[model samples]
Every structure is written in structure tokens, then in C-alpha cells.
Target chain A: MEMKKTILNPEGLHARPAGQLAKVATSFKSKIEVIFNQKTVNAKSAMSLMTLGIIQSSEVIIKADGPDAEEAIQKIATLIDNHFSV
Target chain B: MSLKIIGQKAAPGMVHGPIFIFKKGNSEINRSHHLFSDFDPSKETLLFEKALYKSLQDLENLKNKFTSIDKEKIDIIEVHQSLIDDPEVKEQTLAKINHENKFAYVAYEEVISLFKNMFSEIEDSYLKQRVLDLEDISNRVLFYIINPELNFSYFSYSQLNDSRPSIIISEDLTPSDILGFEKTKVLGFVLSKGSPQSHSSILARSMEIPCLVGAHELETLDLSKYTDLILDTENSEVILNPNINEVKSFEEKVSLFKFKQKQLFSFKGKKTETKMGKLVPLGANISGPLDIDSVIKNDAEFIGLYRTEFLFLDRITPPSEEEQYETYRTVFQYLGHKRIIIRTLDIGGDKEAPYIRIQKEENPFLGVRGIRLCLKEIELFKTQLRAILRASNFCNDLGIMFPMVSTISEIKEAKKIFNTVKTELEQSKIQIGKKINIGVMMEVPSLAWILKEVSDEVTFISIGTNDLFQYSNACDRMNNQLQTISSPTHEGFQRFLKFIVQEAKKNQLHVGVCGSIAHHPEIMPYLISIGVDELSMTAQNILTVRAQIADL
Candidate 1:
């Protein structure tokens, strides 16, 4: 399962948001990856998410593969869509 | 031979000490040697984990230390902790050690550098600055990894157990760095780069530590060779390796300064009076309840100016009336019978509250601020008035003063609100003092001219010379460019003050000078000679001014 979302935080996908994304990804039993600027990185790695330079209003693709792939994609997509405030 | 390096004086005081130079980036880290001769991947990874854990613990301790007092500092420490705990950082560092055959320090540095470079390349300036935080964390971890037995702290001064006080010479001092240091153990500061307006310098000044900024060519000097140094901020000069004669002269000056300070201590509990027979009240201008100790130690007769704005600053929301009342009650309890003249909120201008939503202005000093702001924000102003009125029931000597009033109408409007608040409080069966004196801060030059009209409306006036001097000269006191013309000693400014004093006397109104100028020893006699009824300054200056007044 895959989902596309735009970064809504005015501060962009900085450390805090990336950390949140990683934390959420690790909680699910799915292999998740985020693709931005032609580079794909493990969604559970904050350093990789941050290095993508995903700034405000930028779009990224989230891909999840496993038994709970659909659920993982939904959760990760919602997190990014809400701009990681949670 | 003594080398005299001139710089801008950021804070005023004098001290002599051995120099402790702090160069950023911890350039002393030994990059030439690897942590292990032959790479053992698990061992190296364990070493990294140990250092990371230690660094995290140190940050946690710092966060706890600052948790109660400083919100901004706590947030910064938390960010550093999160970065250290970032799993990706740990994973990447271990991958380098296992695959690349690199040592622990080397692997950590390389991985951290990669992230730092990536952050720096970002278009956002704020994100770019985050690279400094990463660098700070990296330095802490790398320091621990290099010397496993030694403890790691970002600020070296905090860890030093040396008994001798030292002067700090640094490339730049951040607010957190200043906060981390044991202030009493640090005698002075000389920075190669900093502005007087920077938070570090402001903190240094408030802490009363001597500081000199923009000391060019400081970084190139062999710091080890010039261990003993003299920081003479009065002369804006730092003396390196002074000769016998220079040291003797410096010692003489130090003794004279110390002697004067000692003499002032004798006058602490003594009455401040002229040599003839004129008695004047010498008091302290305190910001909050915390300063009551200084007020008592200095034997202040009253709190001439209780600046209430300190409670309003550095918070997201305005203080509630109950909160303000509790603080005011504590202050009253501390002072007991000692009179307190509480100046209402003087926000805007240099001091701003984001929650208030004041419009940006080209010249805030001349814009809607002080009483003008209070008038516009009537509900906020009324809340404060009600709090003070309620708190007045706790003390016999409570006075309310409005700031930045330029017209009779502003005074009338403020007084009307005060009366309304008093009535509301009384109707609610709250016991309030009817003897609470109402006054105005004689800051705006226009107020000085209309002393008759002002005296008709109020019981007293406190001349806020800092603002009066700036407003009268049309020069920003904080602007370095206007240093020459912005002086309070300008003859024209003195004449204005003299005129205001005369007008107050004619109207039989109590008048006082409560400003930084009132703290100046030389200016003390001039203010006394001008017939000002009282002098209020920072509590630290009370004894000094009193001793000077005794001599006069």
C-alpha cells in the first residue's frame, strides 16, 4: 500500500516531526519507506527523513509492505497530513 | 611589557584574574589517532553507545537544572537530548564502524558531519542554525569517546573546581553558556565577537560581571602565554602580561575602589542626609519580590520604584489578577512598613509581550507605549489595577504610578480607571487601602513641562531619567551609533530635570529620581543639590549612593 502527502508544518519535516514519523513507523509490523526527491529511505529512520530536506508544502510518497501494510500507510499518511503536531 | 587591547565595554566593573580562553568546536580533539588499533565492530559500537548514554545523562541533568527558572533553556536542552537519542544517528554511526573499519570517534565525527552538512545546506536559516546544536552534541559525545575516564560538559567553566577566580576570554558566549557557569567563580568576560545587546552580554551585565566585547585579534594570541590578565572595563581595555609598575598602579586603583565599596557598607543602615541638615529618602528600585533581600541588605528606606513589568515579560500569557496579587502581597510582606511605589506595566517599546498583539512600529519609543498602551488595553490595565488595589490592603505604604504619560487627559483616563477598579473592589467587600498614592513617571519631556497639571492629579512623581534622557535628546539610549549625544549628563537634560524639580516643589508634591543615573556616585551630589526629595536605584547601589550623599 502507498500514500502521497504534503508536509504542512511551516517548519517543515524537521527533527521533531521526523522523530514522530519514525516512532509511529516502528510501532507497526510493516516495512515502511518514504520517497522524496527521487530518494527512498526507511520511514523508521529519523536521520534519513531529515536528510531528505522535505521542507514546508513539499510532497512525499510513503510505501508500506507487510500484513498490516494498509493500516501502516493510513497511520503514516495521517501523521504527515496533520503536519506532525501530535 | 603590557599589551593593551581596546574593545567596547559591554558591562562595567573591574577585575584581575588568570585568563581561561574558550575556543568553540573543541579543536583540541585528537583526530590523528584512531580509538582502536584493530577494528572490533561490537566493541567500537559499545564504546559509541557508552559515550552517547553519558552525553544524554549530562543533557538530562542540565535540563532538570534549568527546568524551573528558564523555559527557553530547558527546550534547547530537550532538543539536544532528542538528537542524541535519535536511533538513526546511532545506527548510521555503528554502520560506519562495522563496514568502513573506522574508529569510534572517527565514525561518530563522520556521521555527525554528514548530518551537519545536510542541515547547513537547507534553505531555511533557522534550520541552518540547528547545525550548531548538532555540532554541540557531537562535541560532547566525541569528547567523552576520546577520554573515557574524564567527564564531558560543553562548558568547561562549570566543571572547573579551581579556587582562584578566572576571567573568560571566548570567541563568543551564548546565553546558555553564561547561565551554565558558576557566576561567582567567573570574574570577567572578554569576547572576540559579541554585541552589547546580545543576550549573553545582557546576562553578564545583570549578573554584574565585567565584560568586554569585540576584542579583535584575541583569537590569534597565544592564550597560554598570557595567563594572568586585567579587565578594566572602565577604560574599555584588557591588559595582557602587565609590568611591575602597571600591576602596582592597577593594585592601587583596585584598593581605592574596594575602599570606597567598604566605606559604603558602613552607611548601609545609616540615614542618608546632607552635611547641613536636609534629610532625603534613599531607596531601591526593585523589579520583583526576589530583590527584597537586596533592598533590606542595602537598608533601603522604601522601594522607590517597584517595576511590575518583570512579571509580564517572558510569558506567553499575561499574569492573572490573582497571580499579580499574590506576588504583590509577598513583596508587601517582605517590605513590611517600608513604602513601595509600584509602577504599572510599562510594556511595548523595547519590552514586548507577543500575546498583547501590539502593531509593529518604526519608532516604538515615540509610539503607543507605557500609559498609552495601558489606555488602549483598558481591560488588561484594569485587571492589574484591581490586583494592586487588593494587594494594598496587605501594606500601609503602597503607591501606584503610571508610566509614559504625556497629557492631562491620559492621567485623567488612568485615574478614572483606577477609581473604577477601587470602587469595584470595595463593592465586592474587599478591604483596600484608601491612602494609596497615585503618581506618574516623569519620563516624557512633555510631562516635565506640565508638572503643575500633573501634580494637580497625582500625589508624587518619579523621574525615570533613563527614558527622559533618551526621549529629550531624541536619541535611542541603546543605539551604539548615538553614544556621544545620548548622554544623560547633557547640560540641556540636566536643566530639564532641574526645572521639573522646581515645578514639583512649587506644587508641594513629593518628587524622586529612580533611574540608572541615580546609581552613579558622581551624579549623586548633583541630584541632591538639585533638590530632588528621594533617589531610587538598583538595590546594589543604595549604600553607595547613601555614602556619597553623607559626604555631600
Candidate 2:
């Protein structure tokens, strides 16, 4: 499963929000990957996500593949939509 | 070998213990020239996996250990945790070991370096700063891979547990190492190289660990010969292999230090009062939310000066209302009910932001700055005002203070903008604090003479004696030649303070001094005697100042 989302944080994908995203991605069994600016990285790695420099309003595609792929996409999308408060 | 090494003091307090020479970044695995072909790939893989597992567990434990700290600090540990066993990092490391014929530590270092370089190239300063976090995690994993026999817990380490706490002697330490170490089991730190401003030293100071840095003699001496050592950060020297007399005297010093610390701690919950029963509210001058812990630890009656300029100084663009609101609200959440006086953006003197462009002037200090700069940049001023007003809803006692105000109109203009922002928010149905106090920093000397006129514009005033001293005496504070002239003891400056305090009392306005001079030993008495309502100083000085006030 795959979904597209815009980073809502003005200081986008900094340590705190990136850590939240990675923590959420790691909870699911899916092989989640986030692709931004044609660079693909593992979403379950905060360091990997931070290297993307996803600034405010930058749209990216989140791809997940496993038994829980659908649920993983739903969870990650919610996190991003809520400005990574989760 | 008995020797004395002089170093710069990074933190205070003293202890004597055996020297634990921490060889950071000196793992044999890191220095080895062995290629993947020199060893079994399967063995290297297993070794890497074990190190990775141990590192993950340590990260988990560190995260739990730091749970009581602020959320941002915990987020750092969590970031390291997520990246420790990251499949991406693992895949890259395995590729280096198998395909590139590199050892596990070498492979891991290569991957971390790659990410570090990648992060350093990024334009966002905040993301680029995370490179330090990467280095910290890499060091931890490398330490585990090399020294599997050494237990990761510093608290339960055999050498530390055998006798007195060990003084950590390292070339330098990462901030995380300082944070993750069991501070109780450690006497202090003696780094051969580091500056007082280094993050590690800052962490050492914050953690109240006695630390000495820049001991160049340590490089020549064989550390193995020095089993016992005295870390006297007060004297800025470490005594190696002291004589019985030296030991006995040093022991007395240590006990005295501990007694002084105990006395300071005892003042934590007591009211700051002089012998004459005059109650003086003591507060801390903080730069941001990070200082909230120290402020509370010192039992400050309030935050007298919260410099909001830190939020604006570092970024490519001025912080949006929401960003500033979040920052202010976080401070409010931490302070909870403590009266906080936040100074508006005082930029363009020593602090310059790329986003806020001011024409280079002959004298930037006398040029556009503080309220003058904010007034010229009305939109920026409004944005900050809106944020402060929005966050004021979170705290009961919030004071908005404008800095370097020289005229009545400037205060009225700032208040006008603030009132406009407040009204806009109210019209939008936003709830703000019902009674947010207004104040101004009395930095301009001209304003001192007209306190009666300015007092009506604001409920409180804080004398910014640093700038006020320099400006009043026509002495450049930065110039060494003007040191004598700019001294706070200058009869002119002393008289100015007394006059202002008298004027403030007559005007029925709460007045405080948020300046370096507030904690000056000789000047504190005059300030207290003059009936200043509050004295704001650095967090570290709170306990000592309180004790002094109590004695007086």
C-alpha cells in the first residue's frame, strides 16, 4: 500500500517529528519507505528521514509492503496530518 | 609519577579518585588495518549483530533514564535508538563489511560519516545540528563493538564500584556520554582538550559535575602510572599522586565543598529575605526553555528576564506566530504559575539574524536595536506580540517587556501594537490571560530620569544595568580601557541605580534589576538597601545570592 502526504511542520522533519515518524513506522511489520525529491529512505529510521530535508508543505510518498501495509499507511498518514503529534 | 596539571575550570566541586582513562575513539577495531578477507565474514556479522543488540538495549535504558528530563532531550535519545538498529544503517554497514572488505567498526564508521556529510550539506541549521547526534550514536556502537567485555553500565562498572568514584580522563567526551553516565558513581571529568563553551562542558556544568579541560600535560604523561588523582576544578588543577599532607588538605577542601553545597541546597525552599525582614523576590535570567530546569532547581521566585531573541537569531526566516507560540507555551508549561517576564526581540546589537536586514551603521549598539529595531520592523514586532499574547493563555502571571526603550512614545507604540494584536486575537475568539502585565527594560539612561513619566506606560520596569552602565558613562563596555570607567561601583552609576529605585518606589511600580551587576557582591547590598523589588541573575547564582540575602 502507498499514500501521499504533506509535511505540516514548518521546521519539517527535524529530530522530534522525525523520531515520532520513525517510531510509528517501526511499530508496524510493513517495510515502510518514504520517498521525497526522488530520494527514497527507510521511514523507520529517523536519521534517514531527516536527511531528506522535507520542509514545510513538501509532499512525499509513503510506501509500505507487508501484511500490515494498509494499517501502516493509515497510521503514518494520520501522524503527518496531525503534525506528528503522535 | 607525581605531577600537577593546570586546566581551565568547566564546572565546580572537587573530588579525589582513581583515574579511569577513557580511551574514546581509540578502539583497536577502529585503528586496525584488517580487511574483511582477514577474518570470517560470518564472524564479523555475528560480532556486529551482538554490538548492535547491546547498543539497542543501552539506548532503551538511556531513554528510560532520561524520562524525567525535558521532551526534547528524550527525543534525542529516541532518535538514536531508532537509528541504532535501523535496517537502512544495518544494510549499509553489512554492504561495507561484505562487498567493500571493511571491518565492522570501519564499516559502521564509514556509514555514519556518510550520513554526517549528508546532514552537514543540508541547508536547515536544525537538521544539520543532528550530525552531533549521529556522532554520539556511532561512538556508542563502536565502543560496544570493541569492548564487549566492559559492561556498558557506568554505575555498575567494577573499577567505579571498588572504591571512590573514578574521575573520567578522556581526550574529549560527547554530550551524550556525559548525559548517559551515572553521575553519582563518577567523581568528575578531566578532558585533555575541550573549551569551556563546548557542549560537553556545558552539559558538565548543567549536571553539576566537576570538570577540567585543556590539560595539555596529560598527552605527555603516561596515564596508566596515575591511579589516584585529585580533581580540583576550583583551583583548576589535578594533583596526581599527592603526598599524605596533600591528601589530608584536599580531603578537608572536599568536605568543605560538600558542606557549602549542602548549605546552598538548604536555601532552596526558603524565602529570600534580608536580616531586616525585607522580602526580595529573586529570579533567573534565562535564554530559553532549556534553562527552566535550573531556574526551578534554584527556587527562583520568577523568571525576571526571558530573552526571546534566541528563537529569532538562528533561523533563515523569522519564526512564524505558531512557532513562537509553541516555544513560549512550552516555557509556560514548564514554569507553571511562576511569574515570567519575557523581553521582546532585542536584535541588531550583538545578535544579528540573516533574515532581519538592518543597514550597517557606524555604531550598531546606538543604532537600530531592541524596541527601536522592533518598531522599525512592525510586522516582525506584531508577529512576536501575537505569539506572546496567544501563549499568555497558558500562564497566570506573564509580563511582556520591551527592551531598550528610551521614550514614552516607544512604550506607547509597542503597547499599541500589543493591544492591537490582543484585540485581533480576542475578535477571533482566542482566549488569553485576563491580566498580562506590561513592563519595559530601562536600558536607556535618558529613561532613568523620566521614570515618573514612563511608569504610567508600563506596570513594571527592569533596570538593564549592563547597557545602562555603558550608555550612561559614555564608556564602550567592550573596550578594556573603559573597564574602570564602566564599573558598576562608579558613583555615577550607583547614584543612578539609587535614584531609579527611589523613583520606582514613589511611582508605585514594581522594579527589578536584570543585569550582571544584580549578582555583584559589593553592589547587591546597595540594591537590597535601595528597596529594589527583585534581583534577577543567572540560575547558578540563585542559591548563593539567596544565602547572601539571608545573611544580610
Candidate that scores best on TM-score = 2
List the lowest-lDDT window of 10 residues for candidate 1 chain B. Answer: B66-75
Isolated chain A: TM-score per model?
0.95, 0.97
**Pick by lDDT: which candidate is best?**
2
Residues B1-552, candidate 2: write the lDDT tens digits.
Answer: 468999999887788888887765445443444442466677677778888898888877767765443555565566677778677789999998898877788789899999999898887766655677787778777867766655555522444455566898988777677776667768899999977856677678767789999998898987777788888987999999887888999999778877987989999989899898999989999987668778888899989999998778655456667668878888887885888999999988556475566887888889899999999999889988888888888888899999989999998998999989988999999989867889999889888778898878889999999999888888887899876677879997898889998988999889999999999999998999898999999988999998998889
TM-score of each: 0.66, 0.79
* Alpha-carbon runs more than 4 Å astray in model 1: A1-86, B23-45, B59-134, B153-166, B173-187, B196-209, B222-227, B275-279, B285-299, B306-365, B373-400, B412-438, B448-459, B466-510, B516-531
lDDT of each: 0.80, 0.83
| Clash count per candidate | 0, 1
lDDT of 1 by residue, B1-552 (tens): 678898999988888888877656552465445532667888788888999998888877877765232433555676677788777788888888989877888888898988888777766544665676677778778877776667655335544435567888888876557766776778899998887855567667656789999998787777778868889998999999888888889989999989988887888677888898789888888887656656887899988999998778754346666557778887887785888899999988556465576888888888878999999999789989988888888778778999999999999999999989988888999998656889999998877768888888999999999988888888887899988888777888888889999999999889999989987766767888889999998887788777767767
lDDT of 2: 0.83
Looking at model 1, residue B117 earns an lDDT score of: 86
